[model samples]
Target: MTIRISRRRLLTTAAATSIGVLAMPYLSRAADRPQITHGVQSGDVGADGGVVWARADRPSHMMVEVATTESFSHAKVLPPIAALPESDFTAKMLLENLPAGQETFYRVRFRDLAHPAISSEPAIGRFRTAPADRRDVSFVWGGDVAGQGWGINPDDGGMVTFATMRRHRPDFLLHSGDTIYADGVIAAEVKLADGKVWKNVTIPEKAKVAETLDEFRAAHKYNFLDDNVRAFNAEVPIFVQWDDHEVTNNWSASKQLPAAYKERSIGLLAARSARAFHEMYPMRESLAEPGRIYRTLHYGPHLDVFMLDERSYRGANGENQQTAYGPESYFLGPDQLAWLKRGLLNSRATWKVIASDMPLSIIVYDDAANRSGSEAFAQGDGPPRGRELEIADILRFIKSAGIVNTVWLTADVHYAAAHYYNPDKAQFQDFEPFWEFVAGPLHAGTFGPNQLDNTFGPEVKFIKAPGQGQQNLPPSAGMQFFGHVRIEGATGQMTVTLRDRADVALWSTTLDPRPGKPG
Candidate 1:
């Protein structure tokens, strides 16, 4: 756990590191109430305890407290918790008795009566728990950071690759969907018929649903009052999974898009944007009852984290038969696909990961891959739009549930891709090594019109290309690139780095857990 490489001020030779600890927190201004201009967050950590948050300013409930030290006098403090201006004050604090990979320290206080009076000059984080599900575990993923339209600079794309993955501190975080562009807007109303809007794609204005529920809590306070997305919800602890603009465009709860998937008000505005996106992200449900974030996260015996809801038990496509690749159309339907094939046939966990948000390999896009003019594509030779048999029924339930060590980490293609894609022959979906990695939208940058040269025209391609289909990317991980991974289930081995916003590392690769049955 000692990686101190150099080279990186935002370019050239390329190398970076940061994880020394206990020295970089400083916040003065006489003590208290700044309602943070975007800062304070922690999430899903537990070898024992982890999860403290902050968003401050609740019409006067805000108490919340915690400590390890940064001058709470002798901080060990706990037990304040309030913050509820009906949730706009956002706090959370699910702390709980700490001690498991121990590196303890925290900060986030706000009270005038419960007694911390005011604090928040701390933000040094790191956590590691899950140590035995079976023997192998690694976490890190990507998603559409759709915000701040036009060609770039959405908080320096993926928070500069998530502040360079909070300096290589991975244990959890996988959002394979547009985490919220709730109808973004910046490229000036996205016009076309010669109206101009088409340079970088910002399209905002479509979160329509929730005619009541206070306009769905003002669209979840418009991306939790973005301040580099509240400092990436205060540095990691995410598992969120929802695509389709989190509420509009291409929504499918009985349809809406292009011509007519029919029925409107998009299933009560996608159930009020999944209940305001689980009241702002602590996300972890899916057992049923108009809820269930598609559940499954082990991480100890070495890895499991399934996390699916491919748009809530999918089946709604109507606009001229949308088709997510036939077979009675249903993504993770069939009772969570028989509970993900009996939880990967009684798993022991040595790696399973499928926090997918669509794209189990078979991307066509480019206006459905140049139709009318005829190359006659968009998945015809029997697989493309058929979605190669919904990704060969997830690789035939991992070769009839022998459940080796399947791997995948997806995000709605906003740019930043990697693929090995396999279907045996005749482009069953394009052949070989069905591996896919896509990191994105750190703050949302890089889209269309020759996106910084990763050009996807005349045929659409990506495979970390530069020769084989050609992709040469890395003008700072468009959408501000963000993805980092490290795992050592003793021998499962893993590494993926992709960074930006000064903490650079564009692309990386390493994976070895094949598990078997591919012949």
Candidate 2:
């Protein structure tokens, strides 16, 4: 693979080559070398490029080498990026001008700045670039990891669902939010309903809810402690977004902090958590809005994924029955909603997948005990109201623009289900017919098959969740689920399959593309 190195990178490489002779002796001394704390990862891959991430134990310059072959004999050495204390010793670089429709292997090593002669052992990673043509596309997506006290259980095989998803060998993973349960506390041991004990491999930062920046950063690091997670990260590129749990449970601008949190200001916690989230993952930095999570990921001509940021722009969790489109009804907020509409109208892919962190039409109650206020984009089974208005506007826009073959994929409900939005049977029926498939709880407690709020007429096609008396079931209950998608290059048909922890295909359906020109 030919890489066009920047002038800065070329200079850095030349300097490294010169230092190699003097560094040879120190390299043999393992004790003096810097340490790679976590495994390497790659993400936000496109036709030509992607981002690669790694962390070091101390202040160091992260050196990267890219090659098409695993042997890496003719690897192109990129510029060394610093892994400093400011970013918690983590560093990531965007690798560009790579060949499309090919496997790219990368190796990451940390050269200690303190001891310029010494370097850490390399961590290897790989990712397949998006094809420029209509090649077959496959990806797995799910969310809510290490949540509700269900953390890495050594006895239970340590986040084995990741291992299950890894076996599929998808092109990438669209992590549908709740990447970390920052609001959920992890206990070492807890008695189960079956008269057994569920044990977690815990750390100090995970013992309580994440508040400080270090604590939030540690929450992301805690997931890497699992063998399955680290092994999965090494191979699969992840496109991640955040949700409520990444900050606090159902958090909004007006969130009321619980007694457990000594920090009374929710704003401060959100700020710290946002920084940690960006630093921990391999997400491509947005130039327009640096901290923005809503963006479009075009994966060849087959699929274009629009990942949304519902939490960051939302107003507050309250009675979501507002009739007017105001602050109380703001879900995706004005800017993100406008962006989604524009993106959908401009997308030329056969399938436009809206990768939402939260499921629409699902009645997620912020006050579950009373079932009063809404948490998601639904406000019971009525005409478009509250947050549903924003979604309704998008749907109406899609129909008016004649955009075809749009599908919604989401998690956040802690269950797996397929819903077909039939406009004909709806109270509000301006939108076109579409499908929303939900799958999740990668390694968290199993909850519901939530009640559907038919604002736009969502018909339940298939659902798999805990029974009436089985809410918050343990991961060992075999209900942990995820979703897989594969689009055929020849037919442009999209097949979505929901699977369990054991990699069993619980349910699946294939949708053929509508005969229409791409918008």
Candidate 3:
């Protein structure tokens, strides 16, 4: 389990002397090279600063050096942070006093406490601080990873979509959900249709469903094994939220797992998954309560990003009838919904983006034999029901408060599409019109153009799914998708583009703010 740092050809006596007495006491000349298994990452960028993350193969003190320039000449080294086993030896340091709207370069190295000079190879990363004022803002977002037996293959470019995404150079990436497939296993090879074989690099922990805390932690670590993902994380800051696969398929807080997971309680599994998630990403802590992931980030005066937590407080997936609307169906819970409403009403940004983990109007079905039910907002075809009642209440509040230019961005269905929900054609028409854009399955199997429940008067404007007679295309085939948004500072307009793995634009549209005009 030790990660050896790659050794240099030589360490001259003069260079060792330059390190001085502070370094001599802990230097281990006989120690082998220490490695950084997972590369460095940065996230939670603010106007002044952000957080940088790294993991070492062994117990060590993580040191992050920050600078305005690429070289170490002007660098300021942060105090050493312990990479403890409590967090699976991962460590993150909050960077401060950085200039606004400027790119900051950082590098991480691990120092073995017993042999301090025996350090891991330095891993370099960069991210831009949030703008001090209104300026053009751009970001990319998608979800679902290493699912349906798809794992990284070195021969086929190792999650190449991530490399494609890195080229866009967005300010950050919002991972909508399904950060890992903890509920599924990865085999050495998967047999697809037409007798074609998709190969993968399988590890012992990922060869079965995650049950123990260590297993869940391993699931999150497995994603970092891809070089493309590591390179992408090194450059672009990420805002992440979780979906069901982090625990199990279509899971809710109240639902019990099938017999296969009978040994471990759902609560226990979720706790482990949440801890692993926080350790792996540099997300800001929730102020309302500890272990909460939903939070808001303001990107200058042009955009406000609200990341949601759908799995934490939701009701069971099968309780989708109209009768379940009041007490039995709880999505986002009461506190989070209230926070979202208040935040939206008070936000003065030109565009308020709800980084939802799942789409609103789509009907997500469970695979139970005797029961028919849905996940997400819409339960019936014509009107607000079940969890949709919660969404309806939020939308109604926004319209009553005259909040304008609110849009929803999500990706749980593993397809890409654009839908316009206009109350002009709806049964429950108390809300203002808005748009919801969906995209995803970053490097997993690609499936479906999901059916839309018309409760919110959703009209599909554009969609890109698998061609006829095909479903769940492998990542190697280049069918993965991601969405990008660019907001114009001067005009306050937003353009959203959906692109395939090759970085070719599939669909693009410009949206202008429309004042609230309730029906």
Candidate 4:
């Protein structure tokens, strides 16, 4: 009845083996042990509870214990959750009745049901529950990992930006989509602009574009294999969303896949990618609607985050004609738009944060000819068209409702910048002024300072892009970027800061709740 656990034994046997080094001696000592392969993660942190997640090397009953203290002297043990093959042997448990606005420590272990005594090395993680009342909250938002042929390179610190973000110790991380480059292949060696070859640890599944369900799952799994990513996930609860790279580049429901992915339809690929995404991340699944990823989360009375699913229900990237726009031409479909409107109107929080996977004003041009289209909201240089129409409607509604302090955070651009959109100088002046901050390519190449469409008058504040016309700057050169937001509970002021891989602030700006229209 007494199961003795040893941290030393666990670290020596399990942790030591995963860091790009072989632990043959430890493996020999515990050949049958259920190893916690992907490390531990916590997410969906509510005021009273949160979710703890872990994966086992084999089918086992996963156990989680939560406590306020690191020692876990008075830990609350949750019911055992089965790590089944159906879910790739990953298990998650909801820890309820946890104190709000406080750091909660948790430990996870896997036990063989047949042999109750045998257990895996315990994996530890921590998360902070949402505040029950007004409290200062800070969180980081960014995306586009292992993109532009940049994969995990253990020799070069392996996505070191994740470790840097972890150092900030944000309450949660809003991963603004592109969780994996499912459609992008990672080669063993990539030739950079400086004629230096950047090496990557290439796995079979990541060597080619993902098509099969298992391959898609492997793509998501590849991220966790990195030590830095695993360490970051352990402490920060992530609010995940999906972008085009999760399936393919500039993908939509209507677009036909190239001959390479002829075996799988776009819908099937999206489904497979979504399933893998849900399985790998610790996001809360809705019981009412199981597969829905777009939802809202309230962090105390100060912030309400609306995580959008841009890739799920979208029109074709080439549907850019203003006259061709209708119900079918949607970025955020009618249903999602209605839901967003309702959520924005119903929210009592001071700041309504739209965690968009893509930027609105930036011209994300598609590969189609005529130069007449974009993958994002912008369609033309003038007024709202196609997807931009939907955005304009939402912004107009927000302004008419007098919803202040609305901010948009996105990361698909592969660079970091701040843009303040003002209706005073816009073509369609129905919407009030707002700020949209873009940062990303977390471990990918740096590119943009993308051109802005005047559909909504957006003035660029600051931008940090790759120099010398080089887009694919290796991570080792320190071009990666991410943004952090800190909301002061007392003054209701929000400070947004963009930082590079070196943890140096690229840009920082403080905004009052409603700055009363920019001059």
Best by lDDT: 2
Write candidate 1's Cα lDDT for 261-375 as tens digits. Answer: 2325677767767776765665433336546777676666566778777776555443212345543355566677778777867767666777677655333332334431111
Candidate 4 residue lDDT tens string, 1-519: 012223333223333233212111223347687889899988877786677788888888887766689987556555577888888898777665556787888888888766666777788999999998778899998999988789999778899999999999999999998889998888999877678788888889987889888999888888888999999999999888888998898888666787767565888888888888888888778777787889998788888999898877887777566655575578888889999999988888888999999998888778634554568887767878778888888999998887778999999989999999988778888988889999988998788666788989998899999776776777888989999999998988999999998899999999888632321
- lDDT, candidates in the order shown: 0.50, 0.88, 0.82, 0.83
- The superposed Cα distance between candidate 4 and the true structure at residue 161, in angstroms, equals 0.6
Q: For each candidate, C-alpha RMSD in Å?
A: 20.2, 2.7, 5.5, 6.5
TM-score-superior candidate, 1 or 3: 3
Query: Which ranges in model 2 have alpha carbons more than 4 Å from their true place?
Result: 1-23, 27-29
Residue lDDT tens for model 2, 338-396: 99988988888899999999998899988788877778998888898889999889999
TM-score of 2: 0.96
* TM-score, ranked from best to worst: 2, 3, 4, 1
**Which lDDT tens digits does candidate 3 get at residues 1-519?**
112111121111233333342243333452464568889888888776777888887888887666678875445555578887888888887766566798889878888866776776678999999987878999999999998989987767888889988998999999999999998888998887868888898899998889888888899889999989999999999988999999888777556687777555788888888888888888766556977889888777888899899889887776566644545678888888989988887787889999999999877776535436666776767777778889889889888888999999999888899999999888789998999999887989888876787778899999988876788788877889999999988888899999989998999999987644452
Off by over 4 Å in 3: 1-31, 323-325, 368-371, 514-519
Poorly placed runs, candidate 1 (over 4 Å) = 1-43, 46-49, 54-76, 79-88, 92-97, 100-175, 178-181, 184-217, 221-238, 241-279, 282-298, 304-349, 352-354, 362-404, 409-423, 426-519
| TM-score winner, 2 or 3 | 2
Pairwise lDDT winner, candidates 2 and 3:
2
